[model samples]
Target: MSKKMGLGKGLQALIPSYEDENKKTLRNITVADIKPNPKQPRQEMDKQKLQELADSIKEHGVVQPIVVREVPDGGYQLIAGERRWRACQLVNMDTIPAVVTEYTNIQAAEVALIENLQRENLNPLEEAVAYQSLINEFGLTQEELSKRVGKSRSYVANMLRLLALPDDVLALLSSGQISNGHARALLALDTDEKKIVAANEIIKKQLSVRETEKLVKELLQNKENRKKKNERAPEMEDLKDQLQGVFGTKVQIKTNSKGTGKLEIEFYNDDDLSRILEILLDDNSHVSRETN
Candidate 1:
């Protein structure tokens, strides 16, 4: 499905149904009475952005009501809209508009994550961890999670893979020193050392995603070449030995997959060179005589 359409599906799933008047009623709840959701996906709020939001709340007031659920202590636990709740607190408003709902812990977590996702509030690492928590805590599969979050399965899978990155690399990603594309490209490498090196180069050189990908490809290709060189066949080794014996010197043979190769016979001095040349001339004369 198109991302736009899937996002709508996800939003609908996250939004609570308020068909009944009891569920739909907006109540003025005391700001101090509401506790933040422990499962809220967002870890850090942008202070500058929050200050701007608080200023806007002062001028315009909250346009949308925060969603909350009642706790045993007769207080409300914020299910969604923590940003608005925070803004209300910033302005020291006594009571804020809230929609009371009944939700289990899992439902509350889902609601909070989806709300932040819809608003694009959580960083990539935070988003991945939130998704992982739901999977581990609630046993949601990637497919199920994608449906719940209104994203493609690949998108969810790729996000989860980011967690495998080293802490330093993840820090780079979190701090915006490198983009997600750069991180993903680094995953092509098998070792953390290589990944860290590549990441540093990317930041220092200001490399683009495509450039990083190319660099990774070249590194992998060079690695494979070394592996192939180290794994030469016994037959090739035997051939090299025979050539060395025939030439009275060292010889080397290099071949590629297409049955194409190069052969080099080494000589240490003018005498050695003349000996090799005479050997080649004798072979040529023998071939010519055989053909005649």
Candidate 2:
């Protein structure tokens, strides 16, 4: 591991010792010569945000030096601060201040992922993808990944689960239509259909996390009710069918564990309701006459 370096200490830990002390000092490097890290996990940058950064760079100059490593052919490969490099380009700066660092490809990826995450720049889906890459490519366990990223193990695990979401839900997450909390709530639903339905509802209603949780719970409860209804005895189903035939409408019988239950009959109009009432009243009158 990288010595459990925290946010501020990360850059110092990644900086390499230069044989010539002057080489370690920050210096202006040609913006055109610095190439972006191919392994960089962040796929998108907000152009407006970059423009704001560029405006700042134009006004104050590049305050923080970007980190880069010397490439084999010539120039350099950016290890960190890609946003600043881009902003410098936007401001038409020929050269930007940078620190030269030496790191393996995996180390560079780790540093880039850490920087983006610490800044809360990457969306949930992007964060999850980045974490998965490190786990798959570098064989880092969830615990190790958590420690390296300065996040809880459960947080890492939860973030990884976002990747398993349906593409539609992932799209919502990527596009900022839904939040991480909303996505997490959607995970409670068992099927993709239900999840997509819930996701759409969330976006349409602009639901809060708690509201989304409540909605998922209702959906799961209805699902469980249907499953339980399907598991009922054949005799109960037959009874329901017989009742429906007598009532000339749909009938549902729901029972509890103790055998307590209610019978529900569906009637579409007043005439239909009157017909059902007549049957019940006639049956009651017949029973009363027999008792007399």
Top-TM-score candidate index = 1
Q: For each candidate in turn, give its C-alpha RMSD to the true structure in angstroms.
A: 5.6, 6.6
Model 1 accuracy (lDDT, Cα) = 0.83
lDDT of candidate 1 over 120-238, digit per residue (tens)? 88888889989999999999899988887778899999999999999999998887799889989998899999999999999999999999999999989888876776666765777
Task: Give the least accurate 10-residue stretch of model 2, judged by summed lDDT.
Answer: 283-292
Clashes of each: 0, 0
**What ranges in model 1 sit over 4 Å off?**
1-13, 16-20, 233-240, 250-269, 284-292
Q: Pairs clashing in candidate 1?
A: none
Please give the lDDT score at residue 116 for candidate 2: 84
Error of 1 at 2 (Å): 30
Compose the digit string of candidate 2's lDDT tens values, residues 43-93.
889999999999999999998888888889999999889999999988889
Model 2 has an lDDT value of 0.84
